[model samples]
Structure formats: C-alpha cells, structure tokens
Target: MFSIVGGHPALDLANTVAPRPPGAVEEEYLPDPEALVRWARLAGVIEADEPAEPSAAALADVLALRALIDPVLAGQQLDVLLRRWAAAIERSRLIPGPHGSATLHLGTDPALVIGDRLANALIDLVRNADLSRLRTCPLADGGCGWLFLDRSRNNSRRWCSMDDCGTHAKSRRLTERRRSRR
Candidate 1:
C-alpha cells in the first residue's frame, strides 16, 4: 500500500520509502517493476490506458531518480538534480491538454513515464514553488524524514501528515509531560 501524503508527485515518489528512525531498517514500497507501475498509477503518473510493463532497467532508473531527487528536496544536490531534470526533459514531449494548455507527455515505458514526470515535477517545484515552504519530517519528532510542501496559510506545517507523524509527535509530547509530573 502507498500513502499519497506528499502534495507533489515527486515528493510522493521520494516518500515511497517510508521514513524510519536512525538504526531502523528502511521500508521500500517499490521493490520491483510491477510495484513501480502500480505506484505510478496511484500517483497519477501513468494513465489507465498507458502501458504498464516496464523493463528492469527502467525500474532501476526510477529508483535511481527517486534517490537523486530526495536529497534535492532537502536543499542539497541542485547541480545533480538539474542534470537529471534535463535528461527527463530530453525524453519528454509537449502535448495539448483540455483547456488548450500544453502538458509534458512522458512516454509509455511505465517506469520512464513515472521517472520523467517526477523529474519535471521536481523542476517545476524548484522554479515556481517557494523553496522556503519545503520541509522534511523531523526524525526526532516522530517523523520519518518524508518531504512535503508546507502549503499552510502561515507555512507552519512540520510533519508529513497530521494524521500520521504529527499525531505521533503530539502523543509523545503528552506522554512526556505526564511522565515529568509523576
């Protein structure tokens, strides 16, 4: 199962590996090409009619892209991110959308489609989004290092999800306060 907590598809891809505290084993949701296709569909990177089978190499590339983008999301690796973005752009095409707007059409190879879309989305975020609004769930605060765009009115969001990491952190704080009183 996948959690679509990240507002952007690229962030969601980065989050495919669940956040774990230090010394905890990482949980990877996309373990194979089939899992990647399923995730791409859930993330809206691939259409219902699009080809679903991806070559093994494409799956590796998608995994590699996920690795490359996660660091960039955390405010590191800009030059490397740019190179990957350029590569994605080179493989993509411009296509017409519903309201006469053009959309980037990442081709049919399932993993490549997801990879290219994620790359484009990351660049779009970099170019248009307020980088200050970007944040990582704090591992010490019961977060799993997932990245998210803080779209709150005051941009005060801290956890990946109010229902998940936020709840955990809040509960921990309450428990700590109770223990301190005892």
Candidate 2:
C-alpha cells in the first residue's frame, strides 16, 4: 500500500519504495508499470481517466528519478538532482492555467511523462518549500524512514504516523518502563 505522507508529489514518489525493518526484505510498491500508473493516479500526478501505461524503460526512468529525490531531500547530491530537473524541463512545456497561472505541461510519451512530472515537482519543492520543515521518520523510533513535511505548530513531529510508528514506540517505552520497575 502507498502512503501519501510526503506532502509533495515528488516525495510521495520517493516513498513508493516501502521502508522495512532490519533483516526484512525491502518492499517496492511500484514494482511494475501498472503499479507506477496506479501510484501516479493516487498521487494526483496523473488523472484517473488518463490512459497512460509506461513502458519498462519509462518505469526505469521513474525509479531512477525517485532514487535521485531521496538524496536531495537529505540535503546531499543536489547537482545530480538539478541535472535531472533540467532534462525534465527540456522535455516539458509551460502552458497557461486559469486565473493567469501557468502549468508545466508534460509530453504525451507515457514513458517520460511521469518522470518529467516528478522532476518538475521536485524542483518546485526545492525552490518553494521550506527545506527546514522536511523530516524523516526516525528508524530508531520504529519508523520506516518515510519523509514528511512537519507543519506542526511546534515542529516536533517525530513519526510518519502516530497510529503506526508512534504507537510502536510508545508501547516499547511502556514495556521498558514496566520491566525496569520490576
């Protein structure tokens, strides 16, 4: 299952690769072209009515774009990400939006559309988003290393989801306290 906790399309795409505990086999939600299309629809990168099915090479490009995103979110390897952004921009067009706005129109090629959209999204995030608000779920806190924008008033968010990782961490702490009291 895909979780859209990243708060951005690019980050959401990066999270398609599920994070796992140590010794557990890594889970990839986007294992095939169909899966990529499904996720793109869910992430609002593509429309539900869009009849886009990426080819194997296109899928590979999407996955590669995702790989580049994680490092940029972590504040490393930025030049590599910028290069990909340039390529995506080269293949895209700036089109008019309603209310005097503009939108980046992706090419019709299903193979490159998803990657181009993701790259553009990533660049938008880098330019407009508060990089300081970017936070990764801490693995030591029973998190799956998913990234999220911490928009909390206090900016103290530490888990991807309180119902999931936060509960695991709380239960662990309670058990430890009980044992230590014995």
Candidate 3:
C-alpha cells in the first residue's frame, strides 16, 4: 500500500487540499491528516498520532473512512496506523494521469509507471466492477511490489508471482511458533 499510494501524484493530492495542522507542527513534510486518511484507503491501512491536532469533526471523518476500509476499525477508531510491510517482489505496468502536475507520476517516463490505483479507477468505470477487476499483480524482475491489469477474466495474472505476503507470513508464524515451543 505504501508503494502504491506513496507515489508523487497521490502525495500531491493528499498535500494539495488537506487541511493544515495546528500549533508548532512541522508542515512541510506531511500534509493534512484528512487527506492522509483518505489516501490510506487506497491500500486500506491508516497510521496513528499525526502531528496535527484535528478537530473533532476531522477525527470523525477519518474514523468513518477507516471503518469503510477496514472492518476492524469499527471498534478501535484507530489512533495509530499499523500494517505489515512485506518486501515487494514484482511491479505493475500501471500509469497515472496525462496531467503533468505535482504528482509522483509527473517525472516518471510516460512509458513507465502503472499499478493498482489505475486498475481500481478503470474498474470503477464499468459501473458495477466485478471484484476480480480489483486483483493486482507484480513483475518478475524485482521491479514492482504489486500491479493491476485490465482483463475480462481478471484471472489475466497472479497477484504475486513470488507470493511475498504468504511466504513472509508463514516465516513470521514459523519463527513465532518455534520460539513458543522452545
């Protein structure tokens, strides 16, 4: 999700319209907390303890979004975002806008840069997107972390040729189990 949403354009979008942080907070690096909350939806994870002091309304808005993305947040109303970061194996051939604004895709070569967000957007166009359209994959050359493609079967490709998440999750559990047994 970080690899997907942290692109320049998304960062710009988050920065462009997001509200300002209050007090002695550093404003340069992080944008408004609300925008950050929305962007987190792309990958369906959000962080906690932003530098800003958001209004009760802002906090509520962020919570609403969190509930939409993650059912777990239904109760916690997250104060901090925590997620497992798996090593990226393959990348997508995804592309962002033709607009050359302050987005991450701005400097990327027109021939390059494609991924899941585009897939989500494209799938959004069909009115009723089949859940299959949401599937994202990755390349083999250690290029992208995840990718998405346009296909009718959507079975067009596997999400991860290397199965990074599965392998990592298994490894993590194995280590934990070994320690527990010991």
Say which candidate scores most in TM-score.
2
Ranking the candidates on lDDT from highest down gives 2, 1, 3
lDDT of 1 by residue, 24-133 (tens): 64788888888888888888877877876667876887877777774675678888778877877787788888889997666634446767777778788778877678
Candidate 1 global CA lDDT score: 0.77
Please state every model's RMSD to the true fold in angstroms: 3.1, 2.8, 16.3
Candidate 3 Cα RMSD after full superposition onto the native fold (Å)? 16.3
Q: Stretches of candidate 2 above 4 Å error?
A: 20-25, 74-77, 96-102, 179-182
lDDT of 3 by residue, 49-98 (tens): 22233344544443333222222212342232221001011222335556
TM-score of each: 0.81, 0.83, 0.24
Which runs of model 1 end up more than 4 angstroms from their true locations? 20-25, 70-83, 95-104
Could you tell me which residue pairs clash in candidate 2? Answer: none
Candidate 2 lDDT, 51-145, residue by residue in tens: 67668877898888877775786688888778977887787777888999998777556677777788788888888988799888887666788
Q: Of models 1 and 3, which has the larger lDDT? A: 1
- The candidate that wins on lDDT is 2
Clash totals in order:
0, 0, 19
